[model samples]
Target: MRPILRIFLSLTVLLACVMPHAHASVANAPGANLEVALVTYGPGDVYWERFGHDALELRDTVSGEAVNFNYGVFDFNEKNFFLNFARGRMHYLMDAEPTGDEEGYYVQVGRSITRQRLALTPAQAAALRDFLFWNLRPENAGYNYDYYVDNCTTRVRDALDKALGGIIKAHLAAQAGGMSYRQQTDRLMSAQPWLMLLLDLGLGPYADQPMNAWSESFLPYELQANLRRIRVPDGHGGTQPLVQDEQLLSPNRLSVPPAQAPDLRRPLGAAGLAFALLLVATARRARRVHALLATLYLIAAGLAGLLLLVLWTLTSHHSAWANANLLLFSPLAFLLLRTSWRARRGLAPTRFANGVVVLQLLAALAAVLLHLLPGTVQQNQPWILFALPVWLALAWSLRQAAPPASFAGAASARG
Candidate 1:
């Protein structure tokens, strides 16, 4: 299928699911006839859907109708949507639609859907439903969207907590998550190696912090797991499991995120060493060849560093701010690019190029030294062990030799 059609269908399917109907059921008291369930969807084929999604399901048994309330709603046609997304101001809203179409869509897309029937008092259920209704109001639908803190799952989490008189938050707020946000990110993104590696490089210090259970609920799967352990008031002054009963509406047929982040550090280290060796080996048999490879690496790393800098200083992508990878892929490569290009053409690099090379090398060295600091904790081993050696080798190669043909030019230039 064409990419545009796929995205359009995915967005259509994603946005159109969740609950909508709230018609008055005949002979209803509070939520006496309404049933509430937490609906969790598993990962999908696309990258955005890799994090998964969820909604609250409201079923009015008396009326034989149900609605799903999803907070993942966004519009591609909204005014300045792409602009806002780039500014980290993505506008998302709580959306409601009948539940059946959503189920069909997910099943068709090979994503799983699990429903946990929530045991809430009639009052609690009704209050939660009403709050969702209030949230769907035109003025209220727009919400501050942050992937780590206040996305779709977190919204459902907060709404559920409010309905339960804050017990969910009060109970789980103290519990530390099993993994850091970056670790969770890596686990979910493991299926996409290149994307995962890029994120590992771009992510900054904030992604390293351990999320408390409350914050971790931002993940639909985490919230699903955590809720299984929760006991809410049964309205008779006793407690019962938050999930009264569970049902798998549809089994996941697509790839699922691993329980833990994959470890690639060993292979990364090996690859880095091999690449460094390749540079050294080629440096002897082929000067222009070595210079060509060095120029490419320098250009790629330099552009990446400059992009990271833009994200940190000019963009609101907080996760990209303060990226330590900046040290390894320093923008100084751009300054050194000319000299590397010169060497590729059998021309000698200038003395000033040596200073640029030293500065770049020192920056990469600092990245490794950061691990020795008291509180430095960005998990960048893959980047360091993988990319650092390439930079160092290139620096040494630049300083250690000039093409033999450029000897007279080098002498005259020095003279």
Candidate 2:
């Protein structure tokens, strides 16, 4: 009884998580009243295999029947050990159909389905209409082809362009040899005054909703937050029950999900984190190596920060705040080195600590300026930020080259 109850509970939890995804999948479906199933096949390219999810379905509202959409599938050699095993275990709906190709290539029809009985929300219905518009534009040409392998970007772009019907310049195709995708999107939004007006009107928030793995491409976060939901005006100067987000102001968007790694590599971000950890470790050591370790740590952190900043600019066109923070610790770095120098000279840090603080402030400000500089200028050469910590250490060390306060006072009195 206990085991059975546990199994039931687990299945319940699993169903709960999947319900929303399934609902969202149908929200922007292809057809309004008809049961529609759209299937896409993936090209058998290892680099592009992440796009290889099977079929999708939508119910025919008229017939009340479940429709199976056929996506394109890779025709694997039956004799191949992996393909043979996959075929044996893979439960394809079209398994009873002929597997061999009738045309130029070997063929397999992959399956997918969607079925729900509910009135579509206004936003949900609009999304479906947009998708259907695009899907029919190429006469649904590449929908069943294994596009991820051949020309993934072109396939999606053509469909969307066709759907919009008129050359909808309201989009940014990063792969189309323009500025970076994010930058291009921002520029397009800027150019369309109505889009900006819509955004300020609060219709952008609905557009800004985050995309999951399935609907991976759409609006970026900043733009989505701007769209406003509408409250239908009343017939007699009163409101109606209808509520909707500003769809006219939003951009039509689609994005393919990037491939995932089973064994993820250590990202540069992770590397920076680990290097920060090492600096913390060095800070914990004995007095003898404290200054040396701190110096090395400061240098390492500065370089890591610069590398991260460069990568961030390339990928996101914006500098990261944390990367600039690598400079803030330079004052602390200088103080560490100064204390070590004083220890070596058999003197106390108190003798010149005030001078050290002033130098530290300069280092911090230099760091902030470098961090705030525009990417174009900084990208030309990032080594400029590194100089702050190096200079701070050396300058403060030189400035502290004097006798201890107690001895200096005694000497002056005696003289």
Candidate 3:
């Protein structure tokens, strides 16, 4: 009798806990006249926020319950999170939360939000809702995140593509204009000069390759723009626009005017100034100053080369491989450190130093000529302009510091 009563009590508690959620799930089913929207958020001032964000908002008209499915959520407390991020293997998860709560957070942060209601058929909307719920399941929620390929915006684009049965991609393919990954990134980061420079230095030839329409959708704003132009087949031998309506849910209070065209004058001016200083140092026969400058240049080049090597081989940063900047900033420069030390001691230049000077000149020339090669995509002009003069100056300094030919002849004869 005691055991029977205990089992009955446990069964009652389980039913009470499960019943409400079970009822709610049924009430929010896809067939309940769902309204789907693509929610795009404007960029903020922070570095991470520069690319903006996006999510899929699903509202049940019957139950009046709305949920925002965001694909950008990552737990900082997860094991090996930072390690995975550094290795370019970041794992981001889909999080389905109340639409109001998500919108409130973005509103509080001053990020503008625009919602585009998709003109999906009843069957299409139901399928999309079902897919979103399936993706929200714990076993399927997390996905490997790639910034320029499989990011937050791209995920939503893919989800829509799935629901519409390839209509989005077909529409994008028919579009005319296109830009490379680096070019798009540069356009967005133009307002942040320092950040742009950093990204330019880190990115390689792979980033210069032109992006297809699907790839361009990695950007939230680009996805929004492209989606607006997409038309889905209407089954009556005609097509209809994908976006039914658009609404501005929130306005960015800190929005700034669009950035002006990118100007190379700043980089050229800085490089020119550096070249003038190097010329002055050489003309003044400032041995210590020249040696110090050479050391610093060599160190910078070696570090840049090492970083490029790591990006190419050790990490999953696909866009950073095949770097031509390595030609301008070579780790081989480190080999010249011994030569600089010997010259500072008033010793004759080593045969190795003479060889390094020739190699350095050849490397600089090669870097300058890389743009002429067929299918060559990297824009290494900035690096060439900055590094070429320094290399030339270093070569000149080495030549000046070398032992006279007559002295070399006399020493050889004595030997």
Q: Each candidate's lDDT (Cα)? A: 0.80, 0.33, 0.76
Residue pairs clashing, model 3 = none
Whichever of 1 and 3 has more lDDT, that candidate is 1
Ranking by lDDT: 1, 3, 2
Query: TM-score: which is higher, 2 or 3?
Result: 3
For model 2, how many clashes? 24
Q: List, residue by residue over 1-415, the lDDT tens digit for candidate 1.
A: 0011123433332432243435544113248888999999998878878899999988888777677778887777778878887767877877766789667778899899999999988888889877877677667877868889889999999999999899999989988888888888889998998998777778888898778888888899999999999998766888889999999989999977888898868878898888888777777578778877877887888898998898899878888788898988878888887877676555556878888877877887888899668889677878889887887787767665665756787899999
Q: TM-scores, in order shown? A: 0.89, 0.29, 0.86
* Predicted structure 3: clash tally: 0
Error of 1 at 97 (Å): 0.7
Misplaced by over 4 Å in model 3 are: 1-27, 30-32, 234-237, 255-273, 276-280, 345-348, 403-415
Where model 2 places Cα greater than 4 Å from the true spot, the runs are 1-60, 63-228, 232-289, 312-316, 319-363, 366-415
- The backbone clash count of each candidate, in order, is 5, 24, 0
Measure candidate 2: CA RMSD: 17.8
User: For model 3, how does the per-residue alpha-carbon lDDT over 174-202 read when each residue is reduced to its tens digit?
Assistant: 66537777777776787787788767777
Stretches > 4 Å off in candidate 1? 1-23, 26-29, 345-348, 403-415
